[model samples]
Target: MFTRCWLWIGRLLRRTLLITLSAGLASGAIGYCYYSLKFSGPVSAEEQIPATEAADSRAIIEDAIRVVEQHRSDTRVLRDAHAKAHGCVKAEVSVLSELPSNLSYGVFSQPGKTWQAWMRLSNGNAYPQFDRARDARGMAIKLLEVEGEKLLGSRSEQDFVMFNHPSFFVRDVAEYRQNFAAQANGQQVLAFLPGWDPRHWEVRHLLIALQTLSPAPETPLASTYNSIAPFKLGPIASKYRVIPSPENCPSYTPPAQNRDLPNFLRNALYQQLSIDRVDACFALQVQLQDPTHFMPIEDPSVEWDEALAPFVTVAKIRVAAQDFDSREQNLFCDNLAFNPWQALPEHRPLGGINRLRKEVYEAVNVYRHQRNQQSQTP
Candidate 1:
């Protein structure tokens, strides 16, 4: 079954590779082909909805939340599908002050203050896959002892979750159902749904927009991570990023087909940790709310050009040398929740995708705790 799964995934990836090649020469016909598949009509400036109307995401949020609930495991040990965190290590974040402004939000508002954080790196697939295979990786950072009014009740931690890619596949909650459907079938051991295109270019541009720079990463420490969605920085809106900057230990590529171990990535992380302390720095960039050219806050699909508004360094994150690949720490990391909403009110997650995450994450958090037979909050 594992061999068959690998072959099946290989076939699907070959198709994506072809798409990637064709993407290099983006033509008018290709654009028309994508436009033809739009459920919400042609993509246009007029099609972009306001931040408020786009916030009417309750129905999709509830429906998708129910789907995840139905997929719950009966054991106290299983993890939430997608971003199955395999490693959690001790880390710290130093919040460097940005230019003084009334607009600076949340953790950024009080610059120069340091906060202890836990860094959890995970594979994007719900079910484990070979590290050699192409897949999304996750970097979730939880800034502890944060002092601010909370977005959901009184939570002292500010969580900034990011993916290796800067853009997400789906644009809104309504499209999340389709994305979930693909995932539900793709993870099955036996077969995938017919025409299962997780990178449905016609449906969304993320297939091209958000593909990882590396098909497979040597370690989580090697890749830069992006929040993908916008957040309120005090009164201003911005996105979060983490760039890897370890001296001497550069990111590398693993063998194209090394399927001997299911925990290859974890092993790689442990190997890196054993060598020396890991270092990564975080950046906060303001989003320009251009209602005409770029809908900064709402449509995250509109990739913000770094040349226009470069991300400024707001914090430096360091992961000290430690053993991270242990059953105890892995389980603890699994139990630990890192929701964007688990943040300061000043840094409340902004935009439609973020708005949906507020409810979806809460639902998943409750579901995971119940399945694990443990009630813990972060």
Candidate 2:
């Protein structure tokens, strides 16, 4: 009996050692390949170029349209190929005063600037998906009737889109193209493999980041949304985060009896809005430095370290009390088109991901409108 136990322990130890050795070798090889592709020198402010060229932008846009073409054919449902709205609510964005000079740009220039905004919250899936599934949540805001020269020619509205996570799964449009290509082909494993590879250190780093994830949130108000990608703040670059105001904030108190609801998240928001008004705020944070190395303006995968420059409250958002859950309101949300490109030039989005978004969003609108037979309006 003693001899048998000794043999069993020896075999287990050997197995563990073999597994560890294999993992180390795989990691080392992956690291070597990852480092091979890196640039040795730092990018200076002068050296910094626009995130995307016209050619690349066109290519990314075409790729996105082609990929979604199959999806449109398959579903025949009127929806954005990305986030499909499950909830829509109205809000007021009250611009705060006495901000630092650097922060006082574009929309924040005036102390008392205010706009009537519509908030369209959605599940980050192509269809009206089950709410209990683990997926990213989207917050699309359209700040209306603001007097300004806008990016979406002759329009005065500023549109902002956000996700629950702070960093993107892919760093740029090229990386995302491959992932989306794989997705369109119904071979999502292709996208998953590169991130899983031991050789792709940058991707591994993104994998380790909390921002590349979205846990199932109990309610839209309870979950925080991040702009993940940066935007040009006058001459500076920055990101945004939105959360519920501390006073009478929405919560996640689930009843003991109801555990298996398919649409819990949507239901949760409706219940709260049904009772009374909801309030929330948006915090604008600036990027401290160009950070030539890791935290570059071009990389959406790298999280800007908050330790360098903490965020300041440059703006506050207030959601008005209303029956936002009604069918009429939901349909209203569907008709609206929201994009970061629909903004003032000062707040123009900056980054490869954002550049990709410019074209992808347009393509999405075209596809969505064609499918739904809705009027194509900018």
Candidate 3:
């Protein structure tokens, strides 16, 4: 009886060891796959595969329109992305009095040249939400009286559209189409979640999206903004950024609690401009693309290393003291359309993503204006 019991115990111990080993191996495999998908291998800028454009570009743009329509159908007010405007202020974008030869490109070519412009600050939501909510922010500067032909409309206006974040989440047109399709089909969650299929996983993009929509700044003008994608800086490719002039802009003091203040961001802007009567200023800077793989032309998700290629201040954007939240001003801002494609030839938007934007933005602009019964231009 004792011998039989010993043999049974040994068999049970052996089975338990095997099960433990199997579980460990399975966990290890899952971890390896997760890391591999989250952080991809290095890609050379020259060797990066160009996304195929044969897939119907029109369909992609239509999908974007449909998504926006469905998103705002309940409210019956159709607005494009970044639909809510905090305020549109009158401003000026003046080139630096002295600029380096390499930095003198496009709008920055003529030193000390100032252009009358409208600076629209906005929260990056498809529909207006509480301003205190953590979301991406936008700074769109439309410079009027710019000479020469434009890539889009016949207007002599040039728009510099930027987001507070330095890099975008989508890598290319293909990925952009996928995102629109997912939103249109009401399966937007799938863009981030990896269900049973690993191929549909977008862990990296989801991480980036979270970073993009981080906490809102104390004020819109207080935060820096970036183009994220590349554009033509004369013969070379580059990105642009607008840094807040801290010395000129006042420091913000938040309330002890903000659960009651939904529009605190807009209020901060108002207090700074109308109440305090301070001039807000920013340094418009440019960063040229590196010759190697570090600063990619295709992937907007990959932030160009500032340590490798630092941004050079090319111009100054100044907003004088004014009450920009008037009803008439808000109405005018609502009608305004700021498109990146509405640019001078020398500063044409580059990369497959921007090419898609040229089409998407145009279609969305027309559709939105027609729905609102307003002119496409402000």
TM-score of 2: 0.82
Better of 1 and 3 by TM-score: 3
TM-score for each candidate, following the candidate numbering: 0.74, 0.82, 0.83
The regions of model 2 sitting more than 4 angstroms off are: 1-8, 11-59, 66-77, 192-213, 248-259, 276-293, 376-378
Q: lDDT, candidate 2, residue 21?
A: 100
By lDDT, the best candidate is 3
Model 3 scores worst on lDDT over the 10 consecutive residues at 40-49
Cα-based RMSD of candidate 1: 9.6
Candidate 2 weakest lDDT stretch, 10 residues? 39-48
Query: How would you order the candidates by TM-score, starting with the best?
Result: 3, 2, 1
For each candidate, what is the lDDT?
0.65, 0.69, 0.81
Error of 3 at 274 (Å): 1.0
* Candidate 2, 1-378: lDDT as tens digits: 999999999999999999999999998987787655553225333223455455566776776666555455344544444446657888878778677888888888888677788888887776556666667888888888878788878777888888788777776666666666666678644564665665553444346333433556766776677888888778877777786655534543532223277667767666666654444444434454355544566777767767665667777887654687777677677777888899899888887778778887878787777777777553
**Overall local distance difference test of candidate 2:** 0.69
Q: Candidate 1: which stretches are off by over 4 Å?
A: 1-26, 29-74, 77-81, 102-104, 182-206, 209-214, 247-260, 275-293
Per-residue CA lDDT of model 3 for 162-249, tens digit only, reads: 9999888777877777776675567756766636887777776777888888787877877999999998888778899999876655
